[model samples]
Target: MKKFNFLGFRFLFRVERENRDDVQVYSDTYQLKDRMVYFLVFLMIISLSSQLGNIFQRNKYIDKDIIKENIYAPRDVKYKDVLKREAIIKDIVEESEKKYIYLPEIGKKYSRGLNEFYDEILQIKEKKIKNFDYDFFEENYKLKIAPEIVDGVLDLSKREINSQRKDLMEILDKVYSHGIREGETFITTMAGKDFKDKELSNIEFKVLDIFTFPNYVYDRERTKFEIKKRVDGIEDQYTTVKAGELVLKKGELLDKEKIQVLNALGIYSFAETVLRFSVTGIYLITVSVIAYNIVTTKFKKELSNKNIYGATFLVFALLFFIFRFFGKDYLYLIPFETGFFLLQILVNSAYAFYFGIIALIYITPMINYDMVYFVITLLTILFATRFLGSVKTRVQFINLGIQLAIVKLIIYFSITFLTFGVSETVLLDSTKIILAGIFSGVLTLAIVPYLERSFNILSSFKLLELGDLSNPLLRDLSVKTPGTFYHSMMVAAVSEAAAEAIGADPIFTRVASYYHDIGKMKRPKFYVENQEGGENPHDKISPFLSALVILAHTKDGFEMAKKYKVPREIRDIMLEHHGTTFLAYFYNKAKSLDENVREDDFRYSGPKPKTKESAIIMLADSIEAAVRSIEHKTYNNIEEMIRKIIFNKLEDGQLKDADLTFKDIETIIKVFTKTIIGIHHVRIKYPGQEKESEENKTDEN
Candidate 1:
């Protein structure tokens, strides 16, 4: 058989294999790929959703037919027509040898003259149209007309001379008279010459074509159609006209019908009144990511929850909907850090770093893009990360708030100076920034403490303080009953270190250890430290009475602690540490005397410490005291004592209620052995060392 040591090859090999088996090795490369896929899918979904939203909004405009191309009209006439008009022309022709009128020359000259006449008419008509006015129709004709085409007149005379005839004339007038007429014929004309000075000759006119001349009477019925076409045209040209000269002056509003027409035409849709703010979810995720980084650096462990993803989604959704509710005025309610900072303090600050980016995203819609909120939120997380490790009290939390406020002020003033130029009014904005900081501070002050107490978060500073043996309860023990006090301090050190090593709450272990022996305070004389002159007081009392006295201390300490306003946590440790275990000294003494004493009579009544920390403290307190009783202490002697004590407690079923494992108890034993051995380790004394001087004893006396 092989004698195995932990350092032996076989043992080391087994241990190494176990460690390898325990380690979960995952490929981060795959994780990155998964994240990339998720991000792409997310972006695709969001982009597609936004596009769908845009399509829905645009559908309203499309229903009006304003987006159709062929339904609109031109705004102005061509320069060629303007020049052709105001022309005076004449033609000369030779006559053949004949006494009567010559038909051959008349044929050419007559064609030219007729062309000149049409040209002059078109010129005059086009000139009139250059200064065309639509206000007269809107102000007066629109009211008089019945939204139906009467004659070419847009004939406002509601009592049409004959409705059919009016319709026919309106159609004919729109085709010929309203539009330019075009033809090709030779003509010689002087620019801007008087008609009287020019010979009668051919003239050319390009008649403008009025494609559709539905009158104002028909405007109401055809408005949908006409304005659809008109809007298409107007929008294409983007006409800008002064409202005063157009139809309504600044103070005057259009009649309901005209307003309807304008709406149908999408007049305001194209107005610059539609503002789009750049609110993004990515920026929010960035904040959450930053928070995660900062806090992970602080915690140095994988967070309890993958809160980076959780908080990003939460913040993104919150800000997205927040802007939707408040529109653009969400600035005054920027609690951007509230969710983020609270999450950091409660769970992990790594989660908070990412929330900084989330804050930016959530707040982007509410604040000006160039405002300091983004930088301020980031700096707040960075600065606050240092405090994350040790933040325990409300005062520390308040100080954190102050630090955050200062950061916000610095960022605000810096950004203001950068963006607002060098104006002194920036001082006012800085003041507002400072006020914002103050508000954030107040908000944190109100929230952090409640969360800590409710959630049982243990900060490092809290753990450190709890580990101190100088704490009031432990100090009371040291003064009143030194043996139990010393035992409790040793248990506290052992239990706290073990708890920390196993990733349990060290503060709970340390604090619970300090109060576990509070029950011993009642029978101080029975305890060794308070027993003077090596007197065994327990020998004088009956075993049952001594057992009763021993058992009563658990309850007595509890009542005393409560009466004195000791924290509930300490009281819990005091009540549960013994856990109804038998008063072994009295139980054995009784058994030797009577041989029939009931074991039940010797048990201590208890509620028992329910938590892991309390249970560990219970074992440590018992183990430390039992090991100290050994007269000839060796590593082997201490180990046997630890084994016996643990076995006795286990056999008595005192540990049944606790959820501790055999493995955990073995670890506890190792910690106990190491602590006891260190305390009892040998050291050489200086040669010729002497006893205390007589003067020292006289001073003590």
Candidate 2:
């Protein structure tokens, strides 16, 4: 079991060696399980950070708290003042007048009942029923006419009773026509006022009182309808807050009025809090998912999950805290392009552009989704990613900062002029935006080195630095093994040209080639190139031993590279440049001695060239050595040699895993042929050299 720590996180790997001769090492299933656990842990951290941001945003304001500082609105918001609107509606409803409807049928109904009672009395009298039960009249007419009244009515003559009934009916009609209202004593007053002039007996008055009924009824539905109409007619009470408008003054008390205004602005409500949390969670998860898909699909090899997740986590956390403390007004001060620049330098430019856009979108909500800010930041990120490609020195970053500031000012002024017509406010904001761009580049320059070290990333800046010949490892190679160093220089030149032709990283290829043979420094004379016409070290040793020594160099070189802390890409090139191609000289020599010798024993342990640059280096290394060994240096001979070497490498399956197309291989071949021919061009012999060569040849004959 081996444990490795990266960026404060520990990873455990269980190594299993099946055979010592094989180059590949196997790991147990724990590696996959550990990766999943790491992923889950990262997800949990992201979720928790998002929730913390949500909590901060949701509880940023409180009711009745003293305003410590002025708070400006994030955007223009027109909110209905719920408390004020309700009070207005209440006042309007209360002031609304009540309504009533008249019922004319009440007068007719009372007259009909009185006429029936009279007819019943007449019938009783017509039957000549003396001493008959007066209760019959009460029961039949549904009335409580007294016995005395009944007797009075019966004792009267027919003409007198008819006249009295007619008089009472006229009085009742007059009283009923004047609409009586329930819960009012106007009935008695009205009857007395109209009948005082008439000579009405007590019985007639009592009968008129009994027959009277209230006809005016309150219209509850209609009254409610009118009140509702009035309330609806009242305009809603709305309070508007413009963007950047101060909601509260420093040291002022947040009274009920201010609290109500804040509530209207969505500052203090349970539903609003929940909505903010929901939006934050959804946005974080969606962005994380999209980033995961992009990184895994496009940048899996160039970027590690740790670097991606770690960088994203920091950016998200930084944004959340900035918004939480300073609010959206200061959002432009954040150097968002710092992250983009780091990604561009550490990863691919295209990846930086894509992830930068995602980050810009995520922060747009903080600025209240202002498209102006979004567009400005988007163009800034585009400029940063595009123009800041392959930063070679710290001075370039400073220049980039100045350039970005200028570009940002130009873009801001252009957009503001077209849309907002160049106001004073726009001019002021342009200053802030320009500073943001400059600050981003400065911040990127400051943080890139730390990030490179922390994440162990090999950016182009580091590549250029590593390519310097004054580097300690390269210096050591030159001092210890000058022949191998010279050979490496030639290989680097050819490989760099081929890489440029194929759109690969020429600097990385050149740097990797410079350090590829650092292992030969361990025993310089054992290799033929460094012998310098001295006795061959391989003459005393068996061919198998020589093959072992040669094969051991790739592994030794990988270890030396690790000791010197070279980048992983360079270390990989060191190990893969030789691939598994057979050492034909050693293998043939061993086979001539013993037919039982195995071909695999003479091959270098290799995982094959897995990248276009590594494959080009492999071809260049072989082609350079083969051409240098040629006695007759001709263009056709060099071309034939390069073609044959590439064909042999292809047939040997050394490039099976390399990401090279057939067209790329052809281009590489032309580049190598031309470079090799230039390096080994035919030279005109001087007179002293020609006489020396002829005398030497004559002595030899």
Candidate 3:
């Protein structure tokens, strides 16, 4: 019955170590649950942002329709055709047998002179206005004409000039009255009647009005026909009309580029494109930071250093191109799975699942869809999957991945129906995506074994394995070096008590104590344990060799731990438990034998225990061994031994680098003394064991 109860107790203990019930696993401690909760909150924020982005993208905000119209649409029309339409005016004149009206050379020269004078007048007027002189005006700005122009006009056209002489004289008189001088330059008809030189005084010429021969009115219908023909001609051929004039042809409506410019300023669909670009970019960056936060927070074994956080943030931001280029909606899910897998290996699965939900929220915005189902499914797997004892098997992790995938598919199908009415096709697509996620998750799990082996990382499983006394290395030590093994067990007990008292890590102290002196196993007889009736190996060997051998244990122990692939934290305590403190007995013995024996050679090479818990173990290991050296134990002897060892280590500067304060050392010593007294205390004899044995024999008879 006792054996059964003992076995049951052992089984229950193992279950506690292995059985990570999802809800309790994360929440079993407030710290774990809080981190998981923060992750969920982060994910939800991402989901909301993603939904908002999708809303904006669908609405087509700020879609610049003008750019499309003005910049890209005008390549079809030919410039040569536009010029052809303008040349029809010349055809109309040719058909009328009216030589296309052209001012004579002398008239043309005068006109050019008049235009030049007009331009100068306008520029001077503008300058006057800028100078704030409102009164400024040009009263008699004039261009002088030459007297020889009258004969030239007559030589050009006799009959035509004669017919239009009266009208041309009137026009020339008006021109002189405004700004022209006689005899400098003059106008003539196309037939070259020197009208300017023919004029008498300005009054006589004004009465004749030679330039105003007949107020010829072209037929309105004929003019329209002529204008249309000219337009078509200009469209068909390259023609230069007067500067800055334009011709319109059939099917030509308006300046399209100008219309497009107006449209871009929110005129045609202004809200759509602008909003999509703005919101999509926002969602992309938001999701990236959120995803980075979730993965880095979840997978990271330690809290983030600035460099790691910065690097991860940068990497997540760069992932935007992956989505834009490849159209992969589920790319972040790869990192998400990796984060969860790392969390499980480093911390616990329940927290990992929460992180997955957070990642899902982060991804929702990038994919422009809500990932609530994905988040919930991940949580469900985190809750459902058992992560304790039996979970160490690789096949179990694979099966868990498969299970999680199926759960995810179901959730996705449900979500699809809830968000956008369900269909067989949607379900099928969800399944396929879920299968991909599962494959990624399994691949992540595949790395766990290697990480555990290569990094010597101790999971909760490894810790539990170390706890079992049946472990081969431990069992052999217990048998061959019983005293040392017994000493280690007692140290573990006291160290655990001391660690708990000082608010140090109890598990770390316990584990360190268990493995601290594994080197003593190599030459058990040289040490106190397994010495039996044998002569001291030290007596036969030189004091230097004995000191060397004694000091070698700390190094030997570290190498053995390395060979066994002990985790780094544990190896630290193993190597540093003795620090570089002198093995006083060996050192003093060497000193007594030879004055030249070096003190450094007899000391254990150490980087002193740096953490509070490791330092406590170091002190505990020494006190445990030192107290046991007393043949007859007493409270005074135990107290003196504990104080002396701790004080000696401090005095020798072995504890100089350790973070143990005087207050902590005081508490640790008190706890250590109390525990030592209990372990060494003699128990009262069982009152009736002998009497009961005799009574049991008589009763059996």
Candidate 4:
């Protein structure tokens, strides 16, 4: 057989025992069962993911529809209003003005042309030419100045001409300063308000217009660039719909904008509907796979137990339906922490934490993935698991609830205020969260007993209750078989110590030790412990009968435990504590009487201890009895007897099935030795003890 061990869990490939083919067959059957469990878990996750995703999907709506009732936001929803943003951008772009550039060089060039035209007029006048060709000057200058205006300028004296030229230049400077666009007639350019303040004759205005070419040229690329910049500067329009805020009023028209708000609140459109399902399905599958890997690698022991595994998935399913049906409004009302509490009690705390986190992750999307809720609830679960470790009483559950409530309040306010600031809604939600924390504790207390009974789970609280000496069974043992009761108490003490030393369950070991010999109460006088100076009952019977009487206690204790509703684990301890070891004293006595007497007849009908706690109880019970029987009360004597008893049990093959390692055995031996030494330690003499002893000896002499 090949074996693999990971984190204290062993996986065996095959069994190689001779004449035990049934063992291999059982292994194969278990493997099949394990695989089937994995398949069923996968199927359940897929089915739940599909169903729950659809359950929370929003109802469809179209544009321009009239809503008969009001639609409110299920959760605090903040989304970029795509329709509104686009509309705003479009309006801004359309309202923006076209841009233009001013060319001062155009104005300067036209001014120089006017100055040269004046110089030509002076030359025409100085030449005293009759019938000067004014049309030629107009064509050459590309100006359509009136012939009379040019002739009037030419006939002016030199002083008047300089004054006219200065006035024309001033008019041109004023016109170009304001800029003239291309394709405007000179009449229209001079008819504007800028020229209204100027006092210029028609000829002068004409001269200015002829020189005022379009100084401002339209820049196509610059205009587009400026318009784009203005559009980019417009911020994205975002709409934040608070939880429980109205999206649309009754009798209101559901326009595109309102439909968008609904969609942002998870009221999906056809495309969003498809997307939600696909994304949800993929997320669930991925998280489930990761969770599966974590469990198989870190919690192999929990995975082997069908009940724990099944119950875990059942809790997951319950939480999913609860969150889906209640929606986000009542998310805090559900006692999510109760599931973690139950798991911590029923399973180990580590497994509870892992399962709780995974379940939280699985259900977060149902609540719109509210990160504050997730983080605070996750902290509460963590606190519950860590604080409620090994519950000894129901009161601890109540205390845990109060602590968790306080924790939730502090965390809720801290996170909420930091993220969303203070609000009436936040304060109200915090109160509900506190209530949820308290309710979880109460619910856990209510549910744990039923789960423990249904699953046959032996929780620490159950163990503590069973371990109480006031219980009817223990009371009966104390009254009817005082000697056995005392011996059981000593065994419990040593067993508990050994269990703690070996990292086994001390509470379970101690509790099992208390009930391991309860059957001795049935016939107290038949055993030597309860004989109390009376004649030995076994002396009157044959060795076979004596052995039978002695071995009957294991079966008797087992039946009594079952009748009293003792947990299966404790009852198993009662039956398997003695194992198949022979009654050595009786067997030896019987062999002397009959040379052919069989050892099997004197041995216990045996299924040996199958757990570390049970095995520790067995060792503690034997060592306690053996040490008490020693007449010499010395440290070496007690230590030597303890080692001998453990070695005897080991040599007899009684612990082969106990699943105890050599290291655990060594630790158990050391603990048992120390405990027994304390129980049998020599007491210091009191101040008058020696004198009292001497006086008593003198009186006797």
TM-score for each candidate, following the candidate numbering: 0.46, 0.62, 0.47, 0.74
Query: After best superposition, candidate 2 residue 494: deviation in angstroms?
Result: 0.8
Winner on TM-score between 2 and 4 is 4
Best by TM-score: 4
lDDT of 1 by residue, 491-537 (tens): 88878877876567787677767776676777798776567568888
RMSD of each: 24.0, 14.6, 26.3, 9.7
Whose lDDT is greatest here?
Answer: 4
CA lDDT of every candidate = 0.53, 0.75, 0.57, 0.78
How big is the positional error of residue 195 in model 1, measured in Å on the Cα after superposition?
A: 28
Query: Which of the two candidates, 1 or 3, achieves a greater TM-score against the reference?
Result: 3
Alpha carbon RMSD to native, model 4: 9.7
The C-alpha stretches of model 1 lying farther than 4 A from their native spots are 1-387, 392-399, 402-475, 593-596, 647-653, 661-663, 682-701
Of the two candidates 2 and 3, the one with more favorable TM-score, higher being better, is 2
In model 4, the clashing pairs are none
Q: Which ten residues in a row have the lowest lDDT in candidate 2?
A: 21-30
lDDT score at residue 130, model 2, on the 0-100 scale: 44
**Considering lDDT, which of the candidate structures 2 and 3 is the better prediction for this target?**
2
Q: Write the per-residue lDDT of candidate 2 for residues 360-463, one digit (tens) a residue.
A: 76555555556766887788777777676656687787678767777777877887676546455666667776787678767877877777777667888889
